[model samples]
Target: MTPPTGRPLPFPSGASPLPIPSPPALPPHPPLPPGAGGPGARGPGGAGSTGPAPGWRGLPARLARRLNRVPLRARLAALTAAAVALAVAACAVAAWFIVRDQLNERLDESLATYDISPRQLQNQLTACSGGVEVPSPPSPVTVQIVTAEGDSCVGANMIPVRVTDSDLTVAAEGPRAELGPYTPEPGEFRQGTSADGTETMRVLVRPLGGGGALLIAQSTASMEAALDNLVRLLALAAGAGAGVAAVLGLLVARGALAPVHRLTGAIEYLTRTGDLRTRVPVEGDDEVARLSRSFNAMTTALDASRARERDLVADAGHELRTPLTSLRANVDLLLRSERTGRTLPTEQRVRLLDQVKEQLVEMSTLVGDLLELSRPEGERHSTPVKVVPLHSTVEQAVRRARLRGSGITIDTDLGHWYVRSDPAMLERAVLNLLDNAVKFSPPGGRVEVRLRHGELTVRDHGIGIDPADAPHVFERFWRSPSARGLPGSGLGLSIVAQVVRDAGGTVALAPADDGGGGTVATVRLPGWATGGDADAATATGATGVSGAPGLPRATGVPGVLGVPGVPGGERDRRVPDGPVTPIRAVTPARPPQPARRPGPADGRGEGTGDGAAEEPPRS
Candidate 1:
């Protein structure tokens, strides 16, 4: 059954109830007005108003910003003066309070010790009752008597003290007998003004014998005058102390910041003049001195970098002049020929065109070398490094060298060495080395390349480099007098050195150990014997020269492969199309071997071999 509200009633116990549907969902409330529930909106407690922070809350921040505008030295001095003034003020206040308490205690003791004869008290009492004036007391104190009904009597010519309720209470109490000579009757000590209110006084009230109280007061004008003078003196002293402290603080700040001032001046000089040679003078080994040293070091490095840049520009210009001049001259000749309408002979024309082409190629090679060298050392290694098989890179370089120097023979024995480097850059470095060796070799001379134990050496049986020129061979655009006529920009070895260094290696050129009049360029790179793919390839000896097509095989001998005067041509012995083995460490000299005659299969008379090995011409 439904209730009066039109809702269903509960089901009976132990019976299942029918399902009731949910009420329909209500629509969302409308968006709030512009300022409602926003920054300045009033919440229930009115807490969310967008107003400036209270003065006390933001006082420190405002003060700090204002203080920051002041010079550091002035601020420090002012702080010192303020601190001194506060301390002086504190000490002066303490001294004043102590002196005031001591003076008040003495005055209270004198009032307590004061006593009057009974006759004089009765005379004053009779004078009050009879309405007659009483004579003034002998001391500089004011005396009065008060009854329980708050009536008071004062001495003639003396100001009467205003009686408080405490004095009336004392009067209502019956007077007690004196305790002892040293201990006077108890009384309340308080500060009060005279009845006319013109003078401040210290008042003491004590009970009289007959249901009344006696009051004694002393003027505090002298004590107060002394205290005022002390205050003036303390104020003057504090001012003087603050002035001294400010001066001392300023002097200290100036002395401490002297080095900083010098450093700033040096920096300004450098900035204004654009000179990197300026250095700050260093004295002690303090932090400022260390900063000066660091500044000097920075300038020194900048100067060195500037010098290097200047040298590079000068050298580049010098190197570019030769090829540019030749190009200009060749173009001028072609233009003249075209303008004259004179057709040159085919052979001459072809030779001129070929020379022009060669010059262009040389110029392109030089530019590429410059670009490669211009890249920053860090930028060169920014890419992910790959583990390259050093032997394979060397094999590729050898094949290219053979094609370039077809007349010269190149024999190689490369071991399975793997190094982490940019594969293309590594190949370029190796190619440059091989090309250098090929270029310096005689027309029929052999270039021996050996790689083992992470060291690669390329030896050419040509004019050897002099000991003096050895140091400069790797320098940019530096060529020896003997090799200056050769076709090169003199940046080959420099590029090789830079690349090898980037790969954590070293390259050097020296006279061959055999003293056979040749130069051997040795490159020692740090790498592993086998890694990743090279590990598998090395397992089966797949990295040998025989597995690499287009690469000539190396003769197994340690020194120059061919015998000096063998019947069979040395060319056949230098490079045989057979399986090659790893070369042993190169020694200083080769052991003599028995000379043998040419066999039928040797093809000595059949002219199959190139030619016999001739001794290298001595310098």
Candidate 2:
């Protein structure tokens, strides 16, 4: 029962309303009348749509979606087949219509050629009842005569046509007057169905200059037959063509999509095995080849990444083993002594404990350094970089080095320089350089530190690095043969190089100036603005460097290093006899160039951060 005027009545609990059947789906739009809608209602696009929709319209969309779900090979084949079928169908339809029209036109022209003189027609009619000479129009043509009184008579053919008003009018007007108003011109042609209505006929009524008109007609039977044959031939050819097209389309699609198949297989294999080394073969410069190349490049990158990760793991294990083994051995000894109910000497126990502590610290430092080096620049220092003060960073580094190198004397002549760099990374890089210098210096030997403009130089009075073994300083886990016994890892300079490169700078190692015995490390950073003239500041700054034999004054401004009194790059041409600052150009996995006598400073020569001359590595 209804509960309220506007509210529905409630049913019993657990009862449901009757289900309503859905109506059948309808077309997107209703059948439109000709000229009933807008401009879209007619023309080539609207030809088929002018009538009610076909039954297959709804099914085609669903069928098309299903077709699209098929494999790419099948889809390509189908598309090619459809295109060819369409072309063949269009040409067939066009040819059929053209031939039909041409045949009908020839039939009409044939009808026009039939003519009979007015005198000959009258004579033939006069002799018609006597079975005398009757004017024969043509064999397949049927003729009729209309008298002045609208009477009809058969002329030379078996079939006779009903005389319409137009014929009667032509008769009354005497063969010379206009045939009828319906005719376009005098003696113009007309087409009508034959008496039996089985075939088309071309009709022409001409004025005979007498009291009647002559009607000439021809049967279109032959033309119709010819048209029928043409239609059948066109349909057969179209069908055969479409079939061949389907086969060819499949073949072409297969050949064209071969590369795609290979790529798909490669991707599937990669997915199944998690192997990044799988690559699609590339063979040509086509689009498919380009895609293959891109896939190859991606796999190559992934493989390289995996290799680096493996190497890092292996190297890390190797590095940690020494410290871990020592720590374990010492702890085991302590445990052994306790278990035996015997105590080691106090001094020895303290030393053993100290060694363990040192190992722990070293391990901890190594792990920290590894973490720092492992991350990308963004993750290593998440904060955005701003202009940093290089002078202060150097000062801080020097202080840290002082604590590490107690027996070593440190000298500094830092100039005010500003650069765009991560402050923490810059400071760390400087500290690494300082540490390297102090570690290599002889006892009581002086380590000169100088910062002029954006160039920072750290020189140590130790055995100079051999020219032949100089290039591997920046490779991860690489150590110099002479430095392997030292109590440090080889990652310090590598870290320095990574930081400097991130900050858009360069770092180099060379021998002390003028053959001074020791190694010198130099760093060059960009974006520097200072109050002092760059050239003047660098020239005066030379005072900070100990045992620096005076080279000819370089022609460039201060802070620019080259031979003295020589043009830029030309100093490499003339060789000096004395030992000069070792210059090195460091690149990844490449050997360093040894410093030789200063010659022309041609840019082509391998120049290092130090004012040293050398040749580039052979390719």
Using lDDT as the measure, the top candidate is 1
- Residue 236 lDDT (model 1): 95
lDDT of each prediction vs. the true structure? 0.65, 0.62
lDDT of 2 by residue, 1-619 (tens): 1111111111112222211111122236778676765755564355336644567467878997988789887777777777877898898888878887776666656655655454554444444433355445446776665555554555444455545567657766743543233232434567655554556776677665455566667766777777788778877877787778778888988899999999999999999998998989898899999999999999999998898788778877887898999999999999999999799999999999998888887787677667767887456444355556788888987887788779999999998876545677677778777777776666788999987656788887766665655566776666655455555666677778877766555677766555576777778664334534333534453221112222112223223322322456232122232222323336323234344332232111111121001111111
Per-prediction CA RMSD (Å): 22.9, 19.5
lDDT (Cα, tens digit) per residue for candidate 1, span 1-619:
1111122212112222222211222346898886676556775434575455565577888999999999877888899889999999999999999999999989999888776655555555445444343565466787786666666665555667877778778877746533223344434888987776678999988665455667888888888998999999999999999999999989988887788888999999999998998998899999999999999999999998898788878867876788789888988888899999997888988888987887777666667777877988557656445557889988987887788788999998988877656777677777777777777666788999988767788888766655555566776667665555455667777777776666655666766657586767777654556565344433433333323221112222121122223666331133343444323212223233222232333211110010001111111
> Whose TM-score is greatest here?
2
- Model 1 residue 420 CA deviation (Å) reads 3.1
- After superposition, candidate 2 runs with Cα above 4 Å error: 1-61, 123-138, 146-151, 161-187, 207-213, 384-387, 406-411, 420-422, 438-448, 459-490, 501-522, 527-619
**Whole-model lDDT, model 2:** 0.62
TM-scores for every candidate against the unseen true structure = 0.63, 0.69
